[model samples]
Target: MKTTTYNIDRINHLIQQYQLGKEEFLTLLSEGLKHPLTWEAVFKEEIQINHLKRIDKIFKKGLSYYLDPTAPVTSKESSIFFRKEKFGTNLNLASKKIVSQFEDLKISLSGLAKLSDINLERKLPVFHSHDNPVSVANTVRELLMPRFKKDPKKFLNALIDTFAEYNILVFEYVEHPSLKEKTNIDGFFLQPNVIVLRRNQDYFKREIFTLAHELGHYLLNQEEIESMDYDQMAFGKISKVEAWCNHFAFAFLAGNELLNLDKLPNLTARNDYNFNEIKTISDHTHLSFSAILTYLVKKDKVSGAIYAKMRRNQEEEIQNRKEEEKKKRELEKEMGKASTASLAKPIQSPLFVSTIQSAFFDGVINEFELCKTLNLKPNQLEKYLR
Candidate 1:
């Protein structure tokens, strides 16, 4: 076998980038390249070209990426705001890669917007730290058409579309194949105007809440990646900004009617609200059960102890449902009826899609460039174009 030499320092850097230990690196080399080499060669700072090729393949990076000493490092200038309780000081490599991908997508969308002559200077409503959360919510609500307030689905779609109109880019990040495990990042607001949402949440209501929360960050001009929970709002334990954002999202989604104490069921000593009442409110407002519970807690209708109990029950119910799903999938697999998991659907802003299509039609970008920008194959282009 003709073997070529590579820089040991670059090899070590690549291993670090992939978050691999020496043993794991050797295992990857043995498994991927089918060569079980000694640690002595690595200690001597020598690696075969074939091994380098295998390393490049495993990292999904080019050979030159490992070879070039001046290769640009991934930018970490942007600040990430995560919930300390969820992932304290343990930002995983997978999460960082996801953030990098988000930045790349934002750059592509911005370039396409500029090429299509779209107005990138559109103004978003501004809110100050001192502004009352309710007032800010009302201001945002006023910007939307009256129809959106009538339905939850319409409200969410309209909110996202409205943000896009104001030049705020919203993109959903689906976990990539390279990610070892899901990251706790529910959503993040990037500098200037970019919102990236993790598609791990099963409920659309949660996604809606995340969108609203990130929008609050945008309005306040604060950049943060966060895993927000309604429970964080209790006793003002969270930061002032996070608390404000939560309140803004709550008021925005729940609306002023929910704030009227007289409209809600009166909480008695026995806590006598029936399932019918819960269903009625849920149907009327289209809020999730968990969201309703949170609202009641926020409105002081429920005690913290009761709220915590309800939250626990809700989480248990969700876990049970997931277990049922897992069993069903297993049974399907055993019966040879299991379906292959579908490819991840990348969520793009409607405005971004339109701009890309416009650029393609106007000869500003070719088919290959269009497909690459959209993260689609040549054959998949028609599906998006149509």
Candidate 2:
């Protein structure tokens, strides 16, 4: 039966309350209606197609940074590495490790906190007092500036990547959240040190900026922030703390200098194509493909309508490709692990969420660090809780 308008609005209201993003909002919307999208759906849903593609591109670029910590920054395209999916552990199985580590981490933290008076100087900062992206960028740069003597670029990158190392450690490939989300986020600060992606998947350039933006929040020890839904933000009445986090994220990622529109005209003249000029400029600036495109439109390098059309077209194409692949993989079922493998019988796997939960319940781990390690929101993992 089709849902009534009232039900649909109710559903939307729930999503808004939970802070879901457009991608996540659409996903939850479909799932809540009892029509979970499949690969076929991707082809049908142009927006999702574009989103997944953008995410995959960022994953690839981010992977490059992971593969060679010391590799030259320009080696982004070349230095990236990947294992054949055929050889990688199924994601369902991989998630168990996070559960296990959560317990291990809890114990470590508890030991330190009880034995010593460890005072956390938890003060979060944003651009001194402005909304400039560059201001926040400079703030983060300044925060990490003292560490410049220690591999400057990597530290700069780390300012944006909170959990890059954890991602490298727990899973061989990027992890799609093991659990379903009821909300959208600007992005989730999944692991304490890592920000699971939110946007910047398509143009391939905005990946760094978005990641850096999320890093701004995590750097200051925030848990969850609203997504790019400005409508909600306008009437939503977020706390001052949340606003500060947003300011930090914007500033840290795009840098005030990069976002200044006045300077963009000059930039366009300097290069045959300015911010919107694809190909070399994105790579040269270490910006994502989308960031440059959007900036171009903002600078009047492209019309808003044209930009919107391009975005839609790009999103549609990517969704189509993903849907096609999803179909191929579904057909390859016998040769591949089933998505249901995530619910693999408790005794079947080598990894153990059982052990992790037990340890936490037994007081072997501290709550904060345990939750951090599990990549879980405080009370989200029902099975892992006592």
Overall lDDT per candidate, in order of appearance: 0.68, 0.40
Per-model root-mean-square deviation over C-alphas: 5.1, 18.1
Off by over 4 Å in 1: 1-61, 68-90, 144-158, 176-179, 261-269, 273-279, 284-286, 334-344, 383-386
Q: For residues 1-386, what per-residue lDDT tens digits would candidate 1 score against the true structure?
A: 44554555666655654456788777766774445766775445455677677676555557776666564443344223221123312455456556656765666667776887876664866788799987888878777423545556555566667777777778886766575567766788776788888764456667777888888888898777667566765544677788788878777766755555336764454655444666666665546666677667766777777777767887898999989998998999999995786756756777677878888987889999889777888778888877
Name the lDDT of candidate 1. Answer: 0.68
For every model shown, what is its TM-score relative to the native structure?
0.76, 0.41
Best by TM-score: 1
Report the error of model 2 at residue 311, Å. 0.7
In the range 1-386, model 2's lDDT, one tens digit per residue, is: 11111122322332332334557645533543455554344433123434343332322223222223242322211111111112111222223233223333433543444444332222444223335544555755654422221332343344333332222111111334464422233343333332344333232233344455455555545444234433232234555545555445444444434545335553333464343545344434454445555545534565555555655766787899979977877887967766543421111111123334445666766777556555568667664674
Residue 132 local lDDT, model 2 = 51
Worst 10 residues of 1 by lDDT: 79-88
Query: Candidate 2: where is the Cα deviation over 4 Å?
Result: 1-116, 123-128, 131-133, 142-181, 188-211, 214-224, 229-251, 254-276, 284-286, 334-386
- TM-score, candidate number 2: 0.41
